[model samples]
Target: MNILVLCTGNSARSILLESILNRFGEGRVTAWSAGSKPAGQVHPQSLRLLQAKGFDTSAARSKSWDEFEGPQAPVMDAVITVCGSAASEPCPIWPGAPVRAHWGVEDPAAADEADWDVAFETAYAQLKRRADAFLALDFETLDADKLRDRMNLIGQD
Candidate 1:
């Protein structure tokens, strides 16, 4: 299954979801993340948190949602919004009419902190909780009705 994880900035929540899904999706899923209005750089605290958790952050970067709208775009099985803006913004018609859902998370980049590590840790923990629920889903065994029900439960923790 190909999954597209989206956010407004593609810097924190979306990036973390992509990494966790890729790591735990067991090769049955490939994940990508993008933004409505990208920050143009991955958030530093996100990178640090992922690194501390032993995920490779070297390839992480902010990208636009339009990258997935072209005819040549990868057909997504699911397109999940992990932030407030992408959840509320008018989204482009996804290539495959993929299962769409919102998994809104607090933006760690927006948190005011003298030590940013705490903010990143909070973000990381939230992403991990949601992603764990998502990865636990048995997509291959579900029929359409069951799948819809399961996807509806995607980010609930």
Candidate 2:
């Protein structure tokens, strides 16, 4: 399965979720993340935390959602918005009409720099729980409606 995670900045929460999904999904899923309005660079703290957790940080970047609207882009199985603003804004017509879900997390990037570690860790834990729940489902047997319903319910926790 292919998944796309989105946020307003794409610098922290989205990046963190993308890395978590890719790392934890093993070979079963591929994940990407982008922003409605990108910050043009991945937040350093996000890179630091992900790297500390042994994730490959080379491809981590803040990019626009427009990049995924093209014909060459991967067709997503799901599109998850990880922030309130991104969840509320209009989204691009994702290829394949991926199931959409909002798993809102407080933006760690918006927190004070002194508290970045705590903020990032909190967001990471919340998102990891959701990602793990999604990964636990048997996607091959589940229909799209069932999958979408479960994904939405997972976000509620």
- Which candidate ranks first by lDDT, i.e. highest? 2
lDDT of 2 by residue, 38-75 (tens): 99999999999998889999988999999998779888
Model 2 misplaced regions, further than 4 Å: 85-96
Model 1 pairs whose backbones collide = none
Per-candidate Cα lDDT values, in order, are 0.79, 0.86
Q: Looking at candidate 2, what is the lDDT of residue 52?
A: 89
lDDT of 1 by residue, 1-157 (tens): 8889888878888899899989888898899999888889998888888898899888999999888886898888788877644225443334454477767777778777665778778777877787777677778776756665666676565
Worst 10 residues of 2 by lDDT: 86-95
* TM-score of each predicted structure versus truth: 0.86, 0.91
Off by over 4 Å in 1: 85-96
Question: For candidate 2, what is the lDDT?
Answer: 0.86
